[model samples]
Target: MRLEEIVIDNLRKLRRLISVRRMDDAEEAACKIVKYIFEDAPVLGLDLDGTIDEAPEFFRLLSRIWPGRVVIITCRLDEDKARADADKFGVFYDELVTVRKLEDKAEAIEQTGVTVYVDDQDECLMDIPMDVTVLKIRNEGNFTDGKWLYSGRTGKQIC
Candidate 1:
């Protein structure tokens, strides 16, 4: 059966369980549906400016470790230049999604199927889906509200 057919069937089952107040069953089914929908490989989403370019050395190491799992999501207007910079710094990535606008970041991330998204902007994190883990990489302008899933120092400032 096609993926759409499976999804529709799951939705119908989920609705029936919800209607009967079978909270536990509905939750379990929801989890199973989520697992089946997402791809197996964990994709790491990285911001271009503060996360990657700011610490090229760190990303260089990350690229070595993760290889093709990294996906760069950026709001940079010039995609070619952004890609060129990543290549120059040896920051490996399987995909580069140029967000172009702040509002489009979440949509871009959702489409890419990243498991974890790392960015410096706190507001952008709010737009991303709950299923995707948001890692708030520490920076000069980071939010201290503790809203995101994880916070840590990533990358090194090359001065």
Candidate 2:
């Protein structure tokens, strides 16, 4: 089976398990999904300003855990400052791309072949193609209303 198929199947199983109140089975299924994704080594694209700066520690931990290459895509003009922030926060990333415009992020993602991307800005999220899975980081500033894959006040993953 393809990677997407396996992920979808596991997600369905997880949903069913959760609905049936089978907590243990649901947890196991969730673990399997995460393992499969990491094993596949999907290139993870992350935003710098709102997403990473909001919770640097979480991103740092995720970089350590994720086996794939992590790319930081930002519209920030100052590459030096962005690099400094990454260094200060100890966030591991394979590349740092500074786009000329926020709308150019979609092109950057395409160029880098990012399979999964996370950002807090709705504008950036809107232009990304359907092929790439986009996760909107919920914050007071943006994504206040919409059917996002996940929602949380803080940058940390809520589950």
For lDDT, the strongest prediction is 2
**Backbone clashes, each candidate:** 0, 0
| Candidate 1 lDDT by residue in tens digits, 1-159 | 776676677778889999999986786556445534654557888888877766778877665455236788889889999999888987768889897686688998889888788877765676788999887667656534653333343323455
User: What would you estimate as the lDDT of candidate 1?
Assistant: 0.74
Candidate-wise lDDT, in order:
0.74, 0.82
Q: What is the TM-score of each predicted model, taking all chains together?
A: 0.61, 0.65
TM-score result, candidate 1: 0.61
Off by over 4 Å in 1: 1-39, 143-159
Residue by residue across 22-56, what tens digits does model 2's lDDT show?
A: 99779667755765676658889999888988888
Candidate 2: deviation at residue 125, Å? 1.2
